[model samples]
Target: MVKYPNGTFAAFRKSVGEPTFKKNQKSNYYRKNINFSDRGMTLEQMINESNKFYRLKEIAVVHKKPTPIQIVKVDYPKRSRAVIKEAYFRQESTTDYNGVYNGYYLDFEAKETKNKTSFPLKNFHEHQIVHLTECLKQKGICFTIIGFTSLNRYFVTPANVIAKAWWTQNKSSVTLTEIEEWSVEIKSGFQPTLPYLEAVDYFIADRKSKNGKYKI
Candidate 1:
């Protein structure tokens, strides 16, 4: 059974309709001159760049999960590059990314919200919650990078905490004050852009201490 409503499905289906030849031509024309500086990157791009930096520095082995796609049509402009003419995105994604860091399994989702008061629960999916629960069962570190666009603040909130609140919210929605009380605030940085991993480290350390297993 489809999880989302038919209207939602129709909207995405309509968006997937083949681009006109003229639109494709225009896209090709602009592709070469597309400037990264002019287009401000998404939070996901910043995280990927930070992951690259971490990899180069021998800190972690993390990368964004590749979007699954089914290529229906392709245009061979030249021998080197094959332009994708038609494609359909595959099954729903479980999480934004997952990998290993310091021998720990790391799984997370990245999200940005414009709401000043609270991060909405609708941003998460049932599949993601199940995936996180499975990961936590195996003692993997599962978390989310929540970006508050209005406040320009970010937080690394654990999946377990979120899950509990999400389930509780079946009766009612979780409030902003609750999130502020539970989540760990992450300060933006220069070199890595978003130093969320630092917050993760601290969270892990604190958890270990509570369990009487803190190490020097």
Candidate 2:
């Protein structure tokens, strides 16, 4: 039986579409019996590990923001047991990671795509852009670490570049060619997993050389 408002099986199929349910199924973050160090972990996991490594070595203090949740219902089935039945996102999150590095307030977001041709704009949230803009105004170092999983390429693109593209571009995505010109690709390393600070250093150096002041 079709549960959609269309009701009829054929109509429901047309509305729901075929293979989309499976195609949209989220992939597992962890794989059983697989060596992630060789297989590669998710961008989030890699970044988390890198942050821990950096902190332990007194390199930086980056951390992920905990998104607030609104609890709707709770059930108490036992004397010491309480289960959350319903919850919702309280509000839009600012960005993924933020911290201090060498007297600079660093703020950034990490994103990944399987598409080889372009990075779609749909992956970004409007509130994130607004937050980045605010950070820029405060002279905070802001950027995005984008990974093209299919191409095995990772880039540290400035937040301003992305913000401008989002506002000026007429298309729904930023082309790979454009990103290559605008971004600095970071080489993957075994020690830090994602040594993104290397790219950040390059960006800061360029900014300092360009106008004699490197605030962002």
Q: Which candidate should be chosen as best, given lDDT against the real structure?
A: 2
lDDT for each candidate structure = 0.64, 0.71
Worst 10 residues of 1 by lDDT: 19-28
Location of the lowest summed lDDT over 10 successive residues in candidate 2: 15-24
Task: Please provide, for model 2 over 1-216, each residue's C-alpha lDDT reduced to its tens digit, 9 standing for 90 to 100.
Answer: 111112122221111111111111111122334333347688888889889988999999999999777777889999799988877676667899999888888999999999999999888876777788778878788999898888766777778777766655465888888777767676566557778887777656756775522234
Best by TM-score: 2
Model 2 gets an lDDT of 0.71
What lDDT score goes with residue 83 in model 1?
88
User: Which TM-score value belongs to model 1?
Assistant: 0.71
Clashing pairs in 1: none
All candidates: CA RMSD (Å):
14.1, 12.3
- Give candidate 2 regions above 4 Å deviation: 1-40, 74-85, 211-216
For model 2, what is the error of residue 143's alpha carbon versus the real structure, in angstroms, after optimal superposition?
0.4
